[model samples]
Target chain A: MLIRKPNPIRSSEITSKDNYLNRREFIRAGAASGAIAGASLSAPAALAAVIPDEPLAKLADIRKPSPFSTDETLTSYDDVTTYNNFYEFGTGKDDPHRNARDFEPQPWSIKVDGHAENTGTFHLEDFVKPHTLEERIYRMRCVEAWSMVIPWVGIPLADVLKALKPTSKAKFVAFETLYDPKRMPGQRRRVLDWPYREGLTIAEAMHPLTILAVGLYGEVLPNQNGAPLRLVVPWKYGFKGIKSIVRIRFMSRMPQTSWNLSAPHEYGFYANVNPEVDHPRWSQARERRIGSGLFAAKQPTLMFNGYAEEVASLYDGLDLRRNY
Target chain B: MNINTRIRYVLKPLVFVLALLPAAFVVTDLFEITGRLGANPVEEILDRFGNWGLRFMMLALAVTPLRRVTGLAWIARFRRMIGLFAFFYIAMHFAVWLVLDQGLYLPGIGEDIAKRPFITIGMLALVLLTAMALTSTAGMRRRLGKRWNQLHTSAYAVGILGVWHYWWQVKADILEPLIYAVILSALLGHRLWHRRARSQGVTPRLRANQGAG
Candidate 1:
């Protein structure tokens, strides 16, 4: 005998005329409120939505905003990540965002060798474990006359160099980005010499502000924004901050930077942001802030990108115009 | 109405609208109705204007060659309009760079034009285009007489300079500029080939109003 109980479908679940009308009205009200919320918090909400869903547990402790942060509004994370000049990805501004989706950044290793006491290839996780990550909100000025305020998460390069114990002969620190033609389609083009390289003088590398960044905006760094590890020298042009670093070599002589090798006259090893000296192609006296609306006025570029008090003394005796 | 009359009345106005469309699109994008300009709107605007300017320059240069090949004399009538539109876009590009990018910094603009190789070449092309546009009127053409043809012939040089400016400006991924270079080379090559053939007394069949003046 089938003693089938009545199905336990709730009245709310059933599409009754009164309930259906009420549900539609509720949905309409909800959508209207959402539109209002979106309009009011345009920048931050848009940024939050675009931040990739990666394991951000490493950033748990270092998520607080830094004291060193500028009062200037931070550029949205979407703009910082999507609009990049990582030519290894491609030349187009949005190329890195579109092309680097499948890039394998996890399970990465960095080879730390050449003129260092502790010269060995180490897992990226192991390298990052020792240091206390700190948040640094920095004004990133590009040689192309654009700028952004980035929230970077990493230990200072000075601290990392201290661990390595660079030999006295190590006068410069040379960094190399990963070279995988299959992963990086732009590598097939002869736009730059393969294995993009950059170097900083030992003094510059040891500067307190110089960071070996691993994350941004309270998340694991996006692949386009140099996942795993990268150098961030806020006082210099954005290109000086090499991305996707795989090798860190301590060289005795000034190492050849990628752009300097390609166009020596135009791009110098010391790419410090200077308004007085202009790139032959354009003036550097002003810069358009990224993520600012089209009609927004260009801001006057500060000397050393407003890090003049800290970094200007680094070049006190040196002739910037001549070096530039 | 006759074919010539139909082209002058209808086709000419249509071509004018087509020529003006790119600029109109840029304006609409500026208003954010169509968020086509992306994050860096100033750069996008500058780039789009420059692109249209270069494209119009190519079209203007293609007219004579296309007319000769197709035996369509009416095509030659749109050349002045196309050339003027090219100048218009280039001027807008320069204006945006000056006002929006440079913030009306006259000295900086001067320095860039004087110092930068790419800017120098681009300014030279603009100067040539301006001269051609000013002399485009029938009265001015008669006033300059034979010299008018001589001045207008510099459009070939303008085309080369325009392409060179584009090539020099790019940091990498030069495929776009390379395409322009190839097209310019082909157009110029056709002229050279035809000249050589004519010199050899081969009297090509498409010879109608092919005189240098």
Candidate 2:
């Protein structure tokens, strides 16, 4: 329910007394120079150019260099995903970033159950290490009206599932984020359900576009945004890319996800992030990117976050609007 | 002098300190952001202020009940300051959310409220708090008079909304908000029971005299 789109941009170079309008000597400068207007809008880019050399050098070796890269991505551990769009984490964009700091992710473990060949638990680190970190600049659309371009670091979910070897009967791969009432102070109320469950079809989980990320923007994941580990499905609503995962199960039947089960009509298991399938409440056509130029408007959303060419095959026969 | 005046004298400084706390927190938050505060300073600063608002509002609402139960009528003297504290921090909270987070965009902020029921309720609680804060003064109380009691009684409604507002806002692991909600419910229940007892002619003095040693 938290809406986090890109920040709005306005091109205003003149730091005159009246920031709102054009008048006087400062106005003379604005009148004298149209290029300064454009230059001022590029400030976010100039700021983006500066980066700490640490996280990039320490990039987890498990992730592969992203096959698709974009210069426009908001790449940083804290910026890309730490500020979540999860309503369950409080309706504020920064709530997850603020509230999740207390979580300790090092000693974590994820249980793999159901139709998976391995019914045992996997250490969080070990599980994370098998996959390589890639910088995937993907468009993340929230169920609430907003969007962001994130440079996520992690390997394909298929790479992890390939090692697990889903049993022949496995039809769906269900994921569960850590639901500790202790760390996630939000669990005091029964808003959706504990453990914040989500699921993808086995085929969808194995799709190359579905990633299990450890961190993003060359830094450790922030606690509020499901630090330690989370999923990144470019084609699905951001909720499907759950945070702070603790359990993963491959099931023969479609799994019961928290939101879909809570409100079948409002949220479906597919939860694909499709602009065509508008939520009953609001339009999903446009998105705000974080740190947009001073004068730029929010950009339009792409189908499958521009990963449609890669992920369209998975949803071929399904009606996204009906299933969404 | 009566006990009421004595209680008033004690509460004056206490109320003054509590009243100043919300502003102090805002100043503290600004100071912390200057990079002077300790680790996890931002969250600490935000919570310190936000929780102060919620607690102050609850205490302000408790004034009427406290006055009735203890017969210390002067306890009403502190209600305005406490209610205003609630408004002060809550407004600051909203400001922080809008400026720091959303960058003051109307459409994006509106979408968040509409999509998230939790946010909608939280904002609604703020609206109610603002109403209570504006009407908390003696001038409004006297102007409304009998209507004041009826209108001010909306505090109970706001109290419930506040608890739900906090509860709805959490993402996962909701134990803390639930605890807050339960505590508020029990406190409100006590007042309701006390009111019923009063209407039923049940006075503590009657019990005391009947059971005298």
Candidate 3:
């Protein structure tokens, strides 16, 4: 597999490294966008309006954009949080937003094991703190032909994988989501083989663009938005970015993903966002951006979700149409 | 006039208004006044219209069985109206999908109807419904005479295709579509049971009237 060097200087040139590191300055910097400003100012008020007496104090801190972030306009906090397809929660778009309200994201632990030197169950906080957090504004395209541009706050998956020190036998990385059927009501029904799973080639997992996101729109990850931890593979379809992650296993072979297992002919293992290759059910040539309202025309989908320049080399001569 | 005549006069207009309400809600949602369409309004609109189309089809199918069960002959009068309304909603659903969703892209819409199994079934339902709708008028019914009933019987096939289309489109959470399937089966079952009973010479009051007439 071909490996490409991540550009470290990209973030440094975008903003003053010192100011970007300071949480306060970062919040101020992010306030320029109308969506982020409205989100930061109104989140507490909105939450308060819903639950009049409860004090959600932690919501007051706004997230600042990292130097590595994209310049795309951010989708509104309402659209991002409300319109979700987290099948582990439910199949309806708003089911996750409604059902995940009582889900407890705290007291979380992630197991990092299989073909790795640093193999152990670690507390979510300890595992996250050692790496620098960055806000990457990415275009998330779903296999359902809908898309969203979200400002996600998290550490790169490469940083985490490098810390784990994978052995030579680790040819692929597989992820598993939490499986408590009681907490996750959708799991009660076998919508997907429970404990939703996803996988990537070793090279794809180590790509600089792959992130283990913990938050969106600057607040702590909402329960519905895969609270505590989630993967954000910008180049692939949104299902590849599994949510509420609990385990990461490095294996010698490509692991079966939830959708691919359910319908192999429709959903492929690679799942790279290629517009030319249509899903058996629907066309992927264009996608309707969430929150763009009813009258707006659809935007054409980009190859590898517009990250082709960075990650295309990984699939050098492979036929994307067949692999899809 | 008697109370029955008074009710009959008001019922048609009331049902007409009631049938138009779903379309009105869709229009308000399209304008974003109610904001019920949520993030993906096109999908929401398409889904709502399709849902109403299926619901109207079910209501149309229920008319014959309901009239026989209740022994209310007046209920049979509204059957054509309800069936026409079903055609209206399905047409709206197809229009939104073709014009708004597909952006008037004829080739793509044709390809979808021709290729995708669910879309193919849905289009078949629409075509069957259109034929029923066209032959529904009093003039056309008079001209075709006995053949009209045979053509309209295709509505049963339309209902089956509709429910199947709904069942096939969903990725998971088959609960809603499954409910529709059960209701449709019960409706179809009632017709079959009655037909069997009539064939066995066990004529109920309603069947006796048809036999005598």
Candidate 4:
């Protein structure tokens, strides 16, 4: 139901040539011309006021918010969050967003702890607002075996980590999602071990590819997709990139994540998207692009999602199969 | 005699046709989801088919309670056929997922279930259904006897698993799966309660000293 609304920001920003009104128009023009697609999001910041909120809203927003943005990026909450990654909400590619409206995002604060110099209870908005939204086109591969190209608006994880610098011994990063039985009814049942937990190697956490994204397409993150904030690691299986984050922990040892602990043989911490390492029941040779038909052609799964130039060094010399 | 024979004749075909419905819906929906149906339309189709599978499985589990309440003993006759159809559509769901969607590749399917918990539970439900179907024949039922009953009891487990698999897969919306869960749980609960009462129905009395007399 929520997925049908046209993006609010797109509706407002695409109204006209109002230079002082918004920056989105300029960004759109820039991206259209292939000039500066990944640069600023709107028309040079000079054209927003003149453009009324007609075609788009000021902010747009979903599953796995990208850390990058361009005119091609989605810029509305309806498009962004309503299209999400929460598994309990349902498993259709877009089901989470459609079903996640009731999840109240306010009264939200994440517990920040574990091997950190700066430790305290942080309100979700306080953490989310400080960062400028940059749109990065990311390759999202769900463990459920589908893929999508998402343009997200978020700050680097490095930046977030910098603020809450971990102690020297912090060798891994772990996050927990909200586990309330009332809101997250799925947690009430034992499908997984209640609240979801996911972790990453320290180097993977520090990689430029890792992001603590706030918005996607162009709006604030939607509830189904882990509203307000979630992690984006383009190199790992989607599960390694957890959702609905409520806690951030830095530890010396690898965190025993929900999936890994649930079934160790199947889900390893180094769940890099490797085609060579076969899961017990199925192979990871290829992925079905989400928009494609069920019988649509399959695309070969790339190591580190073809981001090896960016992330392979993180696992240098380590056998991904064993780690996986 | 006429009444009894007529009831059997009608019930025989009804079970067969009711059993085919799940398979029919899944196959038709797979085609719809695969064809150029719009995104929302395809999503609706996939979702509805899944619902039907769940509903039919619940319906099959409803047999005992339904038979007790309505005194329609013939309803019990349909349970196996309905169960097999439940497994059949579940197989279709797997095929759509592995063959058509994932191209029958193992890694993609694993990654999917591994990455997505919903897929994991969904696959588990399918696995349970498959096991139940494999042991569904009269031969296996007789060979295993009590174990067969214990094994087929997994139908309840599979049905619950199906509800959860469907429920968790949704991201934001949840009303539909929740409703299905309630109905299945109620039906299963009735069977459980009934069985518990039946097992305690008669306590053995001590044979008094009347043996000598």
Candidate 5:
């Protein structure tokens, strides 16, 4: 007889409905405590002090241990939140954590347009309310040859797109991050044009593996991790996972992506995890898993980040080397 | 004590301590004494050493201009130490990439140096730095004579390559690398200006600085 061990993180750790409702109160309390923290430490440290201590609004009714989930050791919640590539906040891995402390992802809305029947702005809550949330533990491969396994809580993009009623002409889906420089300090610099944009083919967008994540590790998404909503394409490089989404448009043509626009030769439209196709300066053959200690050797990178079985057919005849 | 004695005792040790701080900080961070290296400690360590190496190279190059401007010949005494520290930090950076990052994967290391332009340039700089470091002693300086000065002129080439290596590695937002490029340009331009001035017999003061340059 096999003995099944209980998982460390479960529904018991999820926030109660009352705690979820009192999120604003918690934020207000956080702000007050942040002010007190400011007196002792420097400005950035003060902001950082408030974040790890405060309880995030934990997501409810998350269906975990899904068939789609990976059985990998989860990256610590602190590492997941702190080390990020949300260029909207800043370019440095730690910059987002430090700078996005005061970012208000609350009262957010997303605008749906172009080749879709649902063509108006809707509150983020309304967009999320319809579907059953799932916990997808995926291997997130960065273009910089770093990897992480994150437990994301989100609804399938296919389910959300079905409600939007995309037309036959909708061959691609383009997503845009919020462009407010006041909140997103990095937006002021024109790093890769003001509003960072990413796109996916209609087929890739509708894949069950693709999700629009609203939370991570059973908690509401932190500001640094793209609060409210963000795209999560498990098979693609992390840059394809656009953060802090404000506008999502269905289009006839392949949409322009920010990194591709920045350097067309280096970054391409189809940013799949292909170990064979090397970046201009670095090898994509291997990735250093984050939180794997200092001396660990980089593991060999997998095709489509080990989701080739699920996503390879989407690009049946396409040359990933050329597309990448 | 006389000024030379004071310089030898007080200034040299102070400069040594100041130069060693970056390495000290890395060791402390590696041990997580202050817990400041963030999530990826190896990357932080690697980047910090590389950044300081470039900074020290800049400092080594700046010594001539500083001595020329300030007329403080004692500053020249620190140049050798500074140049050696630059080598030390750069060697640390390369060691980290080889041992910790690549895990002594010889084939991968060779591929990166041969294929990648940035790594190729960085490797060239390291080779030049190694040659210079080998011949840095006073005995080697006397034995090589005129060839010593000729070989050391490659320092400028190393400076340019270091900056270029940094510029190529950056994904986007070239602000930091751009700043390094600008400083290198200034240092190179200063040398060109002084050399031109010395050739034309423009100023006696300028000609006096040629020995150090």
Candidate 6:
């Protein structure tokens, strides 16, 4: 039951393979020469002019425009795929795009562990077979004071968690990204503790809004965008949406996350997008919308990235300032 | 052409254009005239300017040491132009942060300068560079006399602060900043050795063309 919606515009129609591939080769050659001016200027510029509009691998039977989808302007496919902070690929903003070109996302499988009844490794297709994929246009706000509106295609995490039949002892859900240094070159350097990890309280994990995204913009997830599978929690900061997940565990207690482990003072576990709690290095009150023109003014960061109405009650009594 | 004429007419202008190339690239990227910027163009523009500013400042500092070591007194002639370019790039960095990134938000700017250590150090470096740039003229140099040397000595301080600012601002991967630190250390370290040798009245071979300034 592999569900896939036919794409109206084929990728080849938008930009021929030879056209973009030659450009990529030229940029790669420019980059290897250590010419910073040529690499930085020409690479992104060439990408802008001829960004491929075709979806890589169309997901089957995606329900269009979910009730949870936002009506906001979508960040272009170019920006969404080209600009990423996937440190597993590299730390530079464009490093993921440049470095992750060779990563293979197929033949993927997930290991389910902890107190869950289905405590074994399952094929990716099997895991996704039971759920109906839905489109959720989420507002992704990064802790670095930038944002993107992404239309993700995935199934609800709640339905998946319910099917797994977590035991009463399961109070938290822990996730781990694939940790193959051969595949993920950035892991070779100790960027933020390898095999990037993230977790959520059982309640938050089971929230209706929480989704495990497999694709974006109705296409197969690009490797840089965490291909195969990634988490999408609209209410939280973008870092919380861990990418390229390989493990899901039912934890009895709070599980350690990568960023919180890296710099506890800067990134809290519950990385809800609260404008008031400023990052020590920069203000969190405003965020520049990615793909917005150079002169576009930064928009005021919203509470819970504008999902406070849906999720504020999750932390009714807790002080976010202290927790943050 | 004579070496002096070539340097003044051809080489100096070449260096000026070379220095301006980074800014030109940024301008084109900002307008998407050539290549487009990354997802966040402001961040890209800010970083390009800051990186170039740091580079020019490094070049400014290197002029004296290079001239001393290579016995090239002509190198000193380009120091002012390089230093001014450093100031220009850094000012543009500050301008982008103020206008495009911060959107002319006074409170945010004020808080960043006051609260963030990196921003604070960066601002201090800019202020020092500004003072040096203002007094860089020949007339001001004559008027300030010996005091001019004292004021320009803050260039070393600016170098240190510039590196420190970059070091602190990075999220992770301090490799780039660490390289700057090592380069700055070597430049300043050469100066320290030269001073020590001068005081001992035993000039090293590398100090052959010293006192060009």
Q: What interface root-mean-square deviation (Å) does model 3 yield?
A: 1.4
Give stretches of model 3 more than 4 Å off.
A1-68, B1-4, B30-35, B208-213
Which is the leading candidate under DockQ?
Answer: 5
Q: In model 5, which regions exceed 4 Å deviation?
A: A1-55, B204-212
Candidate 3 lDDT by residue in tens digits, A215-249: 77656788888987899999999999999998898
User: Model 4, range A1-324, lDDT digits (tens) per residue?
Assistant: 111223223433544633333353344334434533333356454222211222222353222334332233332344344444566565444667656667775666676677988765566544554455566778877664556677666678887887787999999998888767677655554556646789887788888788876665565555676766788898888887787788898999978787776677787887888877766655577765655544666888888776777788877899887888
lDDT of 5 by residue, B38-114 (tens): 77877889999999999999999998887788877777888889999999999999999999999999989999999
Arrange candidates by lDDT, descending. Answer: 5, 6, 1, 3, 4, 2
Candidate 4 scores a C-alpha RMSD against the true structure in Å of 12.3
The fnat of each candidate, in order, is: 0.64, 0.00, 0.36, 0.18, 0.87, 0.79
For all candidates, the clash counts are 0, 31, 1, 72, 0, 7
lDDT by candidate, in order shown:
0.83, 0.65, 0.82, 0.66, 0.86, 0.85
**lDDT for position A103 in model 5:** 88
Q: What range of 10 consecutive residues in model 5 chain A has the weakest lDDT sum?
A: A45-54
- Summarize candidate 5's per-residue lDDT along A1-324 as a digit string, tens digits: 222224312432566733543464456456556555665475343333211223367676678788999999999998998998887788899999889999888777677878998655566755775677899999999999999999998999999999999999999999988888899998888677757789999999999999999888888888899887899999999999999898888999998788888888999999999999999999999999999998899999999999999999999999887889
Query: What TM-score does candidate 4 get on C-alpha atoms?
Result: 0.60
lDDT of 6 at B69: 82
Off by over 4 Å in 4: A1-57, A60-95, B1-20, B23-99, B102-213
Clashing residue pairs in candidate 1, if any?
none
Worst 10 residues of 6 chain A by lDDT: A46-55
User: Once superposed on the true structure, which residue ranges of model 1 sit more than 4 Å away at CA?
Assistant: A1-58, A63-67, B208-213
Q: Per-residue lDDT tens digits of candidate 6, residues B1-213? A: 998999999999999999899988887876778897777888988999999999999999999888888877788889999999999999999999999988898988999999999999999999999999999999998898878888898999999999999999788789999999999999999888888888899866655332223
Q: What is the TM-score of chain B alone in each candidate?
A: 0.95, 0.78, 0.94, 0.79, 0.96, 0.95
Error of 3 at A131 (Å): 0.7
